[model samples]
Target chain A: MRTLVLVFHPDLEGASRANKALVRAARELPDDTVTVRDVYALYPDGVIDVAAEQRLVEAHDRIVMEFPLYWYSAPALLKEWEDKVLAFGWAYGPGGEALAGKEIAVVTTAGGPESEYVEEDGGATMREVLSPYRMMARYTHAVWKEPFVVFESMELSDEALVTTGRKYQAFLTD
Target chain B: MRTLVLVFHPDLEGASRANKALVRAARELPDDTVTVRDVYALYPDGVIDVAAEQRLVEAHDRIVMEFPLYWYSAPALLKEWEDKVLAFGWAYGPGGEALAGKEIAVVTTAGGPESEYVEEDGGATMREVLSPYRMMARYTHAVWKEPFVVFESMELSDEALVTTGRKYQAFLTD
Candidate 1:
């Protein structure tokens, strides 16, 4: 299946270690099987080309959104991509079928440890943290995949980063 | 008590109905008690002024983010506000006490009906959908208020819109 990885970090080249490493791993995959797009680099002005994005979505069998969780959500550009690319007539509402039967997945790196996302002690579980994207997939009739999360993203050792990258590569191919 | 209502609608005067009404009602309150700012109008280029926004947050006892729900989240500008304005040293890291002890509330309008958000059959409940903001408040040590939500917002009757606005005004003051 053709996998499209849309990376949505404001600074992939600088100030980001895990996401850049993950992107590098994804890029190492055969071009025919995986296509990686640096979304923020493409839209520095924050204006998304709706037709082009929709076409990319249509072409891919599986869509993976890769980002670092900021304030428990993706960055502004990713949200903008959702608001603009996922248009009413094209993504939902009557006659919207671009995303139907396609698979949607999220791969996020969180700064906090796994324990912080638990249900106990009034904190949100990982499931609840990702519910919005799950619902977004459901809204468009897209098949949702279990998200891949990297906890303690900021403090990962170099060896750990390599392992995580390998795991991400496997996740993409799976 | 001072309240800051940061309205994040892309078009309050043109395309929106519910949010415009809500903002109008909030504006009708005494200036000393409530401060309403049209965030999108303030930053048409999607660039948020972090220092000014920080000053505003510090000055208010309650932060009420009012926005129309797009893709089960606020507009991109709201996410950008969180990223840029809610910085590490100011909002979450050591010595981050700007939002501590303050009240953080979300007042949103959802295009989908209330039934669509129920937890039954894997759909997200209203609480689950708003969990990101809830966690954001916890991260900043702010007190989280029960989110104010208007369901079936796109199709609300004129009278219902007025009622929701009044309820929102009460929510702000209380």
Candidate 2:
């Protein structure tokens, strides 16, 4: 299946380490199987091109939204993209079938440890924190898959990064 | 108590009726008791003034985030504001006490009906859908109040809008 990885790091080249590693891994996937689009690079001005984004969504069989967790959610630009690209007539209202039957998943990196996300651990569970995306998938009638998350992202060693990268690539293929 | 109402409608004067009514009600509150800020109007280019926004948070006892739910979330600019204005050492990490002990409430209007938000109704529960914001309040150590939501916003009658407006004003006071 054709997989589209939509990366949403504001400064992927400069500051991000974990997300950049994942992006590299995603890029290594066979060209015919995977397509990676860095949204910030595409919309530096933050204005999303709705028609183009919709076309990309239609072309992909599986859509993976990749980003670093910010303020317990995806970056603002990603949210903007969702709000603009997934319009009423095209994504959800009557006659909206742009994203139906497509598989949707989230691939994200978090600064905190995984244990910190549990309610008993004084943090929200990953499922709770990412409910917006889940809801969006439901609204669009897209099949939701288990999200791929890498925790303690800021502290991942080089060895760990490489391992995670391979695993991310495997996720796209598997 | 000083209340800060940050409005997040892209076109506050043109597109939304419920939002306009809510903002009008907030404005009717005593000026000393409430401060109204239309975020889009202030930052037309989506370039947020972080220092000014932080000051607004610091000065308020209760923060009200009012918006029309787009794609089950606020507009992109609000997320941008959260990413930029609520910075480390100022909102959450060490020495981040600007929002600690403050009350945070959400006032939102959704195009979907309340019945559609239940798990059995082919939609997520309102609580589940808003868990991200709830987690944000938890991270910031802010007191979260039950959100004020107007479901089936597109079907709101003139009288219902007035009632919702009055209730919204009371909610701010309470």
Candidate 3:
């Protein structure tokens, strides 16, 4: 399947380790199958090109959003992209069948450990935190796939980062 | 308690009705007790003044983030405000006790009716959708108050809007 990975890190190059590594792995995939775009770098001024973004979605079979979990949500730019790019009569509502039957997924990195995101731990599960995206996919008539998350991302060793990258690449192609 | 209302509407004057009415009611209150700020109007360029926003939080005992629910979350500018303004030293993390004992609440307007937000209806409840804000309040040591939501906001009559406004004003003061 043709996959498009939209990376939405505010600082993908700086102050990021796992996300950068994930992008590098995505880039290594064959261009015919995978395309990666850094959203913040493209929209430093926060003005989105709605038509172009819609066109990208139209061309891809599976759309993957990559970002670091911030305040239990996607970065501000991703929300801006959604509010602008996914307009009414295009992504949802009547005559908004552009994303119908397509697959949508999320790949996120969190600084906290996986154990912290449990009921007994007084934290929310990654799935619960990402319910908005899943609901968005449902609203747009897209299939919501299980998310791929990398936990304890802030302190990963170089070897662990490479392993995670390989696993992410497999997840994307699977 | 001193309450600060940060309204984040992209077009407050043009495309808003209920929010505008609510702001008008808020303005009628005593200036010393209620402070209202239109976030999008203040940051048309999307470049938030982090220091100033933090100071606003510090000056108030309660903060009410007022916005129309866009894609089941706050407007992009509100997320930007949180990402930049709620910094490590001032909002959370070490030495980030500025917001401790403060109260945080959300007042959101939705185009959909209240009945649509039910599990049996294949929809997410408002409480589940708003879990992020509750968690953010928890993380920051800020008290999480029940959200005030205006349902079917797009179709409210003038009388209904005024009623909602007055009730919202009471909610703020109480």
Question: Of the candidates shown, which would achieve the greatest DockQ relative to the real structure?
Answer: 1
Candidate 2 stretches with Cα past 4 Å from truth are A121-123, B121-123
Q: How many residue pairs clash per model?
A: 0, 0, 0
lDDT tens digits, residues A6-121, model 3?
A: 99999999988999999999999999899999999998998999999999999999999999988988899999999998899999988998888999999999888898777553
> RMSD to the native, candidate 1?
0.8
- Worst window of 10 by summed lDDT in candidate 3 chain B: B119-128
Clashing residue pairs found in predicted model 1:
none
Show model 1 residue runs off by greater than 4 Å: none
lDDT for A8 in candidate 1 is 100
Q: For chain B alone, what TM-score does every candidate structure achieve against the true structure?
A: 0.98, 0.97, 0.98
* Per-residue C-alpha lDDT of model 1 across residues A28-107, encoded as one tens digit per residue: 99999999999999988999999999999999999999999999999999999999999988999888888999999999
In model 2, what is the error at residue A152, expressed in angstroms? 1.1
RMSD of each: 0.8, 1.4, 1.3
**lDDT winner:** 1
Which docking band does candidate 1 fall into?
A: high
Ranked by lDDT, the better of candidates 1 and 2 is 1
